[model samples]
Target: MSEPAAPADTIPHGDPFAIFEDWFAEARVTEPNDPNAMALATATPDGRPSVRMVLLKGHGPDGFVFYTNFESRKGHELAANGHVALLFHWKSLRRQIRIEGPISEVTPAEADAYFASRHPESRLGSAASDQSRPLENRQVYLDRVAAVRALYPDGNVPRPAHWSGYCVRPEAIEFWHDREFRLHERRRFVQSADGGWTSTMLYP
Candidate 1:
């Protein structure tokens, strides 16, 4: 059985990143799978919005990071609109965090290091994928993967120039905790001009 929720009064205040780390650590222990998975929301230049799950490859006070093909749908959207929103929901802990921010590309070195760290097959698959593009059939993709694999049998596939990561520099972060009786606890932290954060509680 899951543990009881923490008392509302005990919700951490100040340093939202610290609170995030604490909750994320707990999530890693309780979430059945993909604790690092987050919903990444992006929008087209004209306001068409889309959301999809992406793994949180890295994060800290700097920002959260995720990598993808820069030519993909979300990637193209991000290129046109630097802003994005991310959601991290951990059902096991009945908690979710929402982040709004602008994105900036991660360094090529970072992308290369991460790509190299992936499993051999994962590396091959990502290298072979033409993300967000229509495919004639599964066999075509398989053949592409096979072709790439054949060229680099050791699975040292080079990261595609279009493949990279983005860091979301959050302007605002909101944390929500579920409680009993339909009541909930919420706190939102917005970055201040001085590079600190100002927080306020919201009715929930």
Candidate 2:
């Protein structure tokens, strides 16, 4: 893996959002799968943390977006705490991006649009499974799948009301680049009160 440039001026911009887009664009060409995959960390109201892998579906100046069942464990946690952290590591580039932010539900209309764009089977699965819920057995889960398949036999499934998208409006974004001898470079971009990003270097 190539080491990130020492001074961090090689990228020459303070806006982490734009930089993330650029990196993602490059990953699309180099990564073997799901370059948008991120590890999402959510905490309970009492501060117990849980982390899981989730696919990043959207990104813009507003924030990062991902879709899931609103009643899932992550959903319940986000609802109670309203904060999250996400990490994206691209092995091909030896780089990592971490974000911490406020979490909020995306508009239902927006979620509908994105959900409709998904593959029919995925849409059906979303409707069939109550994520993070306990099942009596594997056969019971299979039965639910069978039921959903019967209902949507023609492969035209609608998004469930319990399913939607969430957006993480970041307060901070940190970029990391691995280097030789464990001297990695870390730069943090924090959102300013005036709605701008300020970058600072950290020892690594």
Which candidate has the highest lDDT of all? 1
Poorly placed runs, candidate 2 (over 4 Å): 1-11
Q: List the residue pairs that clash in candidate 2.
A: none
> Residue-wise lDDT of candidate 1 within 157-181, one digit each (tens)?
9999999999999999999998787
RMSD of each: 3.2, 3.1
> Local error of candidate 1 at 172, Å?
0.5
Residue 124 alpha-carbon offset, candidate 1, angstroms: 0.5
| C-alpha TM-score for every candidate | 0.95, 0.92
TM-score of 1: 0.95
Residue 115 accuracy (lDDT) in model 2: 88
lDDT, residue 23, candidate 2: 84
Task: Indicate the residue-level lDDT of 65 in model 2.
Answer: 95
What is the C-alpha lDDT profile of model 2 across 1-204, one tens digit per residue? 996666634443567877898888988888999999999999999999999999999999899999998899998998899999999999998889999999889998999899889988788778889899998898887788789989888987778888998999999999888876777888899999999989988887
Error of 1 at 151 (Å): 0.6
